[model samples]
Target: MDWTVKAGKLSPEKLRSLIFNRLHRRRSDILLRPGLGEDSAVIDFGDEVCVVSTDPITGASCRLGWLAVHVACNDVAANGAEPVGIQAALLLPEGVQDEFIGQLIDDMDAACAQLGIEILGGHTEVTTQVETPLVVITALGRAPRDRYVTSAGAQPGDIIYVTKGVGLEGTAVLASDHRETLLSLGVEEAVLQRAAGFFDRISVVPEALAAAEAGASAMHDITEGGFCGALWEVSAASGWGCEVMVEAVPVLPETKAICAALQLDPLALISSGSLLITAPPQVSIVEAVARVGAKAYPVGRVAAAAEPVLILPSGERRRLTMSVEDELWRFLAGK
Candidate 1:
C-alpha cells in the first residue's frame, strides 16, 4: 500500500484510521481542548490559548531552511494567530559542508526576522541516517480564546475563498530543481524566474490576519494537496459539502504553462502560499484580501449536501478528492 492517500485512492474511513487518528496522543491533563482534526493544535493557556503546529520539508531540500519556517508558520497563521516563535530541527547528510549549514541557518534567520518571529532552540546534526538535508519547524502562536478559527467552523452557506494563485510553491520548486528540462522546453527564462520567485510568497500571514479581521469563520492553508486537497480538508473538517467552480479557481499563467509542459494537473499540485477561507457569503473577502495586497476569489460555497463536489465549467459534477501523491512525486520521479 502507498504511504500517502490521494484522490479517488482512499476511502474516508481508511484515511481517518491511518492518518488523522494517529496524529494525536491522548493526554488527561488538558482542558478546553478540541480534537486533532482542526487546523492547529489548541492548548489551554489561561486567558488566551496557543495554536501550535509542526511540519517538515520532505519533498525538496534546495531551500529547505526557508521553506521549513514558512510552511509551519503558515499553519499557525491559518488559525488566526500571529506566529510568535519557531523551533527548528536541522538534519544533514554526513558529507554536507559547514558553509552550506551556515548559509541555511542564515537564510532561516533572515526569514524569521522578516516575519517578526523569534527562533527558539532546536536540534541540529549531521548524521549517516540521512542522505539529504531535512528541516522540521514547530511554530507557536497565540489567539484570543474566543477568536481562533478551526476547520470545523464553516457553515452550509459560507463562501469559500482562496488567496493568491494556485500551485505557487510547486511552480517554484519545479523551476529550481528542473531548470535544464524547463529551459529546453521553451520555457522563458523570465517565466522560470517568476516561478522560482514564488519563494517570497510562501507566507500566509497577511491573508490570515485579514480574514480573521473580516470575520472569517474558518481558514486553511493549501499545502501538499493543493487546492483540491485543501477543499477536502476544510469540507471534511467542517462536516459540510462544497461546490467549487473549476473555472473560478485562479492560477498564474506561468503555473498553467508549467503544468501543461509537465502534463500534471495544477489543481493537484502543492500550493503552500494559498489560503482557503470560509466566511459569510455577504462578506467582502476579495476586498479584505486586497487590503493586504493579496488577491482573493470565490471559487465555491459550502453546500447543504453531505458530500464534497466540484462543478466543472463543462457542466459536470464530480466528487472532490485529494491525494498524497502530489505534483512533487511526479516531478521528482521525472514522470
Candidate 2:
C-alpha cells in the first residue's frame, strides 16, 4: 500500500511502527533514546547526562525566532535538564531581505540572553524547498547522572498537574497572525493585545526545574499538542492510562476569548507555554511551582483504565479525543 501524510506531527501509532521500531543502532552511553513522547535524547557524560532536543518553528510567523529557541530548550527542560547552548539550522525561502534575517536573529538572541544560553554554531541558507523561513534549533543541556527524569517514570496513582493556562501559545499565534480576522469575528482588540503579550510567558523552565526538584515522575511540555495531548503522552510513555478533570484545567480568559472567536476548542489547540507534570501523591508540587513564580493546578491522575479518561466540565465521564492533529492545524487545513 502506498501512503502519505499531511502536515504536522505523525500519529503516535506511526511513530511507534515506522520510526521507533526501526532504529537499529544502540549504545550504552545513550541514557535515553527515542520513544513515544520522549522528546529529548540523553547521552551519558560521566558526571552529567547530556540532554539534547531539536524543534522546528513551523506554525507561528510573528515570533518565529523566539519560538525556535524557547521551544527547543523546553524539550530538554521537560526532562529535568538545564539547557546550556543551542545550534540553529535555518532554511529560508528566496526573496527574504537582510532585515528579515536581522530581526529573526535579534529575536533568537534576546531569548538566549534571557535563558543565559548561547548559540554555538549552525548553518543558514536560502533554500527552494520551503515557502517561508523555517528554523530548526537543537538545544543541549545537562543534569546530574541518575537525576534526570524520563517520560516513562510516571506510575499509576501519581498526580498530574498543569502549569499555566491552556492554549497560551495558540492564542498568541492567532492574535499576531490573524488579528484582523479575529477582530472581524468579534474578538476585542484589548483581548488580542493582552494575548499577544503571552510570548513573554512561553518559557516553562522555572516550573520544570522546580517540579524536578520536587521529585516529578514525569514532565512533558505542552507543545504542538495542548494539555490533553500532553496528558495522553505522559500516561502512554509510562505504560499507563489517565483520568483528567476538564474543569480543573486552567484556561485563561484571553485564551478562551480567542478560541471562542476562532470556533476552536482551547484544550485541543497547540499550547507551548504550559507543562504537564506528574508526581507521586505525596509530592505536592503546586507550592514548588508557586515558589518559582508559576502556578500549577492539579487536573488529572494516572489511572488503571486502558484508555484515556476525561471528567467533562458537564460532570460526565468520557474518553478524551484521540485525534493527533492540533486544533490549530485542523482549523487551518480546512481553509
Winner by TM-score: 2
Candidate 1 error regions (>4 Å): 1-15, 18-39, 322-324
TM-score of each: 0.92, 0.97
Tens-place lDDT digits, model 2, residues 235-310: 6778888988899999999999988877888987888889989999989799999999999999888987676788
lDDT of 2: 0.89
Best by lDDT: 2
Candidate 2 regions off by >4 Å? 1-3
Query: Model 1 over residues 124-190: C-alpha lDDT tens digits?
Result: 9889999989888999998877787888888999999988999998998988888788888888899
Q: Any idea what lDDT model 1 has?
A: 0.83
Q: Report RMSD for candidate 2.
A: 1.2
Give the clashing residue pairs of candidate 1, or none: 5-324, 6-323, 7-322
Q: Which pairs of residues collide in model 2?
A: none
